[model samples]
Target: MTQASESHNGLPTEIPSCALLQLLANSLVLSQTAPYLSCYDVLNLAATARPFRFLVYHTPNVFRRLELGNVKTAQFDIDAIDRGGETWRNVQLDENLTEDDFYSGPLRGIFSNLRRMDILRDVQVLSLDGLSVTAELVHDILVDPAYSVRILSIRGVKNLNERKLRGALQYACRSSRPRGTPRLKGLYVFGPRDTVPALAAAHEGSGSSSPTSPATVATAWNNRSQKALSDALAEEPEAWYVRRGSQFPHRISSEWASTLVACSGIVSFDSVLCTGPRHFNSPAWGTVNTEALDAAASSTAPSVPHFSVATHSLGGCASCGAAPEGWTVWGEEVVASRRESDGRRTSESCMTDLARFPLLAPPPMHSASLRVAMCPAGQTVRSRLPFIPTVKQQKARFIPRCFDCIRDRYCGGCHRWWCESCYIGPRASSPGGYAASSTGPDSVSSPFPNTSAASDDNAGLVSKIRDGVCADGKCSLGQR
Candidate 1:
């Protein structure tokens, strides 16, 4: 029923009980504001009232990208808070505590709200990174005929692999997508393979425990948290656990040719080259770096060159332009005569060959060293070395052909890599003497000084270095 109120002018005004919601849900107002709100913000707003819940849930724009990474953290916080710090610490310290012993505990409130909302209706991009999502939830999202998600990121999702993704991929390939709309491009399964060195150093400096010490406890937490909310809805099938095989299950090996045959919908496989965090700018994951992938996803393109950022090792020779297999750098005396007895290349042999090449990989800001010259392309280079110490000290993160870059020269002083042109060009001979020596000048006379590793701006630091200006605005090369 409408109620009448007296205005300041003594006029009778009709005000409805739902007047507030009516004004807020006006098309003009919603259109102006809805785009800016995040998934959490929308969910939080919806919880305020019943009408708001219906409005937020019905809006397709609100669910374009679903980032539920924080949900996992929320679950952890509730569990830790519910159990006192002493109890939680005891659980962490328990040596005999198996992963099976841990459970998600009571965290069905926010998660229950999440499941009730129809956030998946028009979702184009879905990120479940680090979430303990159930196989049922994953299957329903992927295999369902109603929901259509273009790009699904499942990095760090426990117990998920090719076996679980098979039905989704099959459905994506066979299903018909509307014109101009995105088709299921790829399912990302890559994440940070190892902890950042800076983080490890920070922990050590802070007198924190070893990173590996909490791994068992973390595993147990992840297992118990898997579908803690979904379990309330329905029990998962036993086959879901059986198919995973091991506690640490292997995803579809992108290295295998059979993987492509199995998952036909996936335009590109980047599980091997994912060396950094998945959310931010990583050249390894084409969706974050390249628009060419989006175009490829819509059209029928058998091969996507832009998708292969880590295709070649160091490219061809700078002079004759010979291929990597036959071409060898001039001063590469390390593996000059190295030969494979079986005439077949393995990962081990590839890493051996990579040792001879002068290369540099971009480091994530969190892990960047003050000693090294930074590259704008920010991501950790994944390198596993048991043999070569020279390259190890350089903090080379990736193996040969792991990342795509063409640098013919490496400087140990500035800890930077350069191409022949950049090494010999006028810019190299500029004020900073950036190219003065392959091994930069002595610290006392060197123009290119190391910047602080604490600086968050990589682009600014790299720009300043390339311009050949010292931090003090003086030219070390004795020229302006």
Candidate 2:
């Protein structure tokens, strides 16, 4: 046989390098393998050659899921670990990076690193779980005009306050305007119940003049007994209180109630409360009662066909109930219920106890139970009926007539009905030519005819009634 041109190791040595590259590029291994690489593995591959860099950084849909901070192994990236380590420390200390610069500073390197990758623009689902998430980080992400993030999950994040939460929500709910629509659709936030107070504080400090601010409704409680309200606040600071004059009597906190009402484009918001050992044991366990408050308010607000809020506490360990010395039943009924049972316990039995003693039990330790669904194009505040009580007949009689004048008209002041003349002052075209007098406290009431000292107390009472009505002949009850 003619001496065969020896092929190197039975390979085609004569094949051109360009053809070999084309063959490799066309092979399923190269074309389809990038999607299978772990984020860290992809980073390593990108560092090896230009082709991989192009594949990972420039390829569309290659990085649809971008997770930062601590997540399950499936989402964790080694490159993120390195980025958060000493490399990030050096970047923070760099003199060239200004504090105001959006790209530099403590707690900002992760975002900067993400920005550099360019692949994040395509990220559809972003999870910032188990990270030291700053308000600035959240603000930057949601406020970015070009951001394409759709679903965001924030669990075990630190320093996340209500201002940041509200800012993010507002940004997510912001209309795209000329751009057509927003990309963010859903947000999930879960954490210890202790954070609830921080959220309240943030809302209080925001100084927003919107109708939903707690300050606007603070006056609605002016007529209530201060001592009683103070006692309730002392017992449970996060407890919800119904406005003394609201149409629906269900109680809820002004701040959170406004938050729920102000929310637009929200399809559903659900919160669950679970009693944990931390509530009893932790020093910071005061404001863990938002679930009950939210649930109560949900019933009073305008009913949305899609909106719903539900809250329930989880039962403590039944085995713990058996432990004689260290164990403490949540309430008297819990202790009795445990004793009444047939001495058999299952998860179902514990859950049954949870339902049976919902409000009787103390607040929960963990409150990782806030879930919100948003529409892609954003939403408008649902049109709500004015929060005025509807007419009701009972025992062949109507109640809530004006204490002064017995007429059946909506009472915006005390949430009762009053005749139009008594509640809204004398009509403009009165037959007696009596102009509508000012209802201010200083105004002398002509209704009380007695001038003697014995009638002085009665005069004071009449004066208080006049002060209760609006000076403009309109109901002075603040916005719900």
Candidate 3:
């Protein structure tokens, strides 16, 4: 078995040709030949040689992303990381570290909305829960000409007293310098139950759209908002201590007119809490009155209060998902009252799907002549229920959501929640006025890059591409 002993016993003294290369080749063969290798095998393979160990250690593209657990942290340095990408969740800690080992952690605060943009963009979703992010820091990030970011989703910072919060939204996303647009213009803010009202009055009118206000988009969008809407639209899950207002991106004046309007057959729907469709099943559906819901179902009525609101909050048949308990139906009136007895009839009707309008406001549910269905979306009912995703996110590091990303293989792109026939397919068939991609052919790349020319052009293209830039140089093409 020993080479020296075999040579001594009468064999060629010369060693086998290229033993070092052959051993290296054998190791490579074993790596490829093994149908499957366990994590231990991988570690063993890394131990094979110094070069192999470093190859395994520094390889970034091995995973589409690196995920860290709540109790775990990656000792990763992202400098010049052209090979790998990583994402962190529950990255926030309730306790501030004692020693100076602080990058201050990830962002955990609610942010105000910013206008969409067109440019090479960098987005960072920051959370600011129970902590303070000073205005000076924001000024440095936003005001500094070099620190331009496309999207900034600030979540959870409900702890900032009123003054700091105001400064963040007003100036952080905008710049005072002339001829200079704000790098942080597209902003999203959430948390602290009072922020909405404060910002709403400042941006839009106190209750309705003003010709001068940009936030005066529509009241219908906010009329049937769930309490989670503010938190959900933000960068994080339902942030506790969040300030709730029904209408977001709404003109200030429209706030007065928005309310949760209930349709027939359903009694109560919780707008603040998305307690999954409890049927808003009203006793009126079976015994006293069924016409209100029937009208909404039929889509008929010229006399009902035109400026009304509705929702799936309790009227449509389960056979047709058109009316969920929180969906807003219109053209009918539901008399809403607070005294528990004042009864005025409110008609309910749904519009054709082509336009996709939202509920404005049902009548007001109040003590005197409280319209039976005028409760606002922000108004809470007596029944308390835990939100579905909130309970789920608590246990998981991050929910794998394919809703927004289109490149996902199985869930690539949200075809279900959004209109499929509309912008769902190819951008070519998309309606002229609508599209998320502002850049035309000049900036876009062909999805089918398997062509011969593409292969030649991509000389150093990665094998299992975790993420990449396309011909147009877009950093987010096919990003998971």
TM-score of each: 0.35, 0.34, 0.21
Ranking by TM-score: 1, 2, 3
User: What would the per-residue lDDT of candidate 2 be over residues 1-480, giving only the tens digit for each residue?
Assistant: 453242554323332334533343433444355444555676776686555454456445555555554323323222322232244433433455433332213335444565686666766656566555556666666657546665555655655565656655655555553353445544445322222111122224356554455765664344234544555565432111112232112322223323333343431122212122112221223322322212222122332212112121111111121111121122212222333267764432121122111121111111111111211012111212222224641111011111111112223454433222122222221222232236643333333122232333222222122334533365546432
Q: Model 3, range 1-480, lDDT digits (tens) per residue?
A: 554332453323332443542443343443333223333354466587554554344433221111111111222232321222343333333344321122323221111111121111222212222343444445455555534442332333322233443453454333354355444432233322123221223223356444354444344334324333554466422211121112233222211112222111111111222212211321112221222212211112133222222111122221232222233322222334343345755544332221112211221212111121222233322113332345423211111111111121111111112111111122221223122235642232222232232332212122111121122233342222
Q: Relative to the true structure, how large is the alpha-carbon lDDT of every model?
A: 0.36, 0.35, 0.27
Q: 1 or 2: which has the higher lDDT?
A: 1
- Best candidate according to TM-score: 1
lDDT of 1 by residue, 350-411 (tens): 22222122212211112112112121122223333342445424222222232222221222
Ten-residue segment with the worst summed lDDT in candidate 1? Answer: 238-247
Candidate 1 at residue 420, lDDT? 23
- Model 3: residues >4 Å from true position, as ranges? 1-131, 172-177, 191-480
Candidate with more favorable, higher TM-score: 2 or 3:
2
In model 1, which runs have C-alpha deviations exceeding 4 angstroms? Answer: 1-38, 49-55, 72-115, 134-137, 162-183, 193-256, 264-480
